[model samples]
Target: MSDSKYAFEPAQFKVICVPGDGRCLFRSVAHGACLRLGKPSPSENLQKELADELRAKVADELVKRRKDTEWFLEGDFDTYVQQIRKPHVWGGEPELLMASHVLQMPITVFMRDHKSGSLLTIAEYGQDYGREDPIRVLYHGFGHYDALDFHPSGAKSKLFQK
Candidate 1:
């Protein structure tokens, strides 16, 4: 991973790369969810399965919250939900929001700022759940996302330091 002026020290966090299948976002979230739960990382096959399950749950959550979400989504909300249910479909901010609601946990998205040459928090979801330990994901500034985990030694990220 490239150095980031705003990132935690390389030793503080490890970036776990997931398959680049269109489901990268969901896979990353699933992987992070495992870490958050104090479980070992799931196998690649398990991750894919978890991603699919999460996708389904997210679709359901979207339908359940259509009144509050339809305004921001593009095109027909029903169509969006159907499209997202497919395994190859890629998810973005809307899906992430729904995932947070589905899992009832906070999710934090980070990205490298090209201009500042630093990693930065770009978006967050599920703040109502709490902020103590969010499911951390690093967006590659494109369409890809990877999970972030602190070292087992318990070193904290400087980005979160006071």
Candidate 2:
């Protein structure tokens, strides 16, 4: 196996549906995260609406599967993880940090296969402006971390979703 590198990279996401719903089905194939919905592009405010709807759906789905609720929880969780979890809470321009709050949900990380699109890679660790080393926040903590480390790979190897 190849060694995983801990560095900043743009995360990717794929929209999918929940299993029984003929129409309410969305999956983030890249990340193995699945979702179920009732409509296709259901609302006029598509982007924001989907984020809100998916936020709840993703949380429910993660909970049902005994997965950490990090992927599903949004808003405060994102801010807390991106900002406070790492020992160093103030890294770069404060203005850039503001943009992080704008996202309604956690961005799924993806690794593209040779065939075509990207596959989801569970984000076990994240970078913060204040800390020199990446922080491996606990998914169960909703982005909270108890310690700081400088390992190349953020979290323990066993943490990936699948």
Candidate 3:
């Protein structure tokens, strides 16, 4: 992706691709959680396990915050939560928001600008948790999400330098 709109070279960030199974969103978030904590990336098997664990937590979070979330949900809130608890179910924006609450950390989502070929910040969650050192994830605009982390050089882009 081009970095023309920002002050960092593209090489400073690396995308950690996860399996495109229906749990991609959760997998991406799990991977990002590791990076946010300055921990080494988890192995593929561990990533899947973490994703499933996170999916369960997110479901509980949605239920716990039902008063705030149910209104915007599409179907029976109970059913939605039950389905989301399953391992292979897919998650979208709603789940992403709930993830922020569950993890109590900020998540920054980026999407590739199709026309400009640059990455754009499409959505951010968990501002109350603070904006520093957010977990970054890239949305493919299809049905996939991937984790984005700093390269070994530990460089901070101007966009993120604050």
Candidate 4:
């Protein structure tokens, strides 16, 4: 049985669903992070590149700390690096950090637990970032994402009809 038994009431909000390819996490992060960029970013590919760079920075830091690349990755570090640089692979906290840095805004990820009936922030950047509105994303899990739009009552959006 799936642990995702409970769910948010669909009628209460609009859920923007993105592609479920291996890159969904990065794409969602990119959308939220780009809102405060002052101008639009060229594409999702650029944000993916930013995430790859962030991971590379982490690898460099680990090397500086004398940790072998294998400690945090598999096979050859260079190959792994190349793989992540391309699209489709998932990115986690490191990418979030990079997105936060690149956008100069805080990112708040809210993760919901149907089992426990709760929701909370899974990641956050400090308040020092200059932007007015923080970029926020709803993190469904390691593999998927979702967004809720609070439409006015009695207005049924055709896009999200049950």
Clashes of each: 0, 17, 0, 1
Residue range 66-142, candidate 1, lDDT tens digits: 99999999999999999999999889999999988999899888876567544577787898988878898889867
Query: 57-85, model 2: which lDDT tens digit per residue?
Result: 43344334333434444446556444422
The digit string of per-residue lDDT tens for model 4 on 39-100 reads 46426566556444555554444344334334556667666556655556665554555555
What is the Cα-based lDDT of residue 161 in candidate 4? 37
lDDT of each: 0.84, 0.27, 0.82, 0.52
Question: Against the true structure, candidate 2 has what lDDT?
Answer: 0.27
Better of 3 and 4 by lDDT: 3
What is the TM-score of each predicted model, taking all chains together?
A: 0.86, 0.22, 0.86, 0.54
Clashing pairs for predicted structure model 4, backbone only: 14-149
The reply for model 1, stretches above 4 Å from the true place, is 1-7, 114-117, 152-162
Question: Over the stretch 1-162, how does candidate 3's per-residue lDDT look in tens digits?
Answer: 122233223445677888988989999999999888888999999999999999999999999999999999999999999898888888998899999999999988887666754567778889899988788888888888888885535364443221
Give the winner by lDDT: 1
Error of 2 at 19 (Å): 30
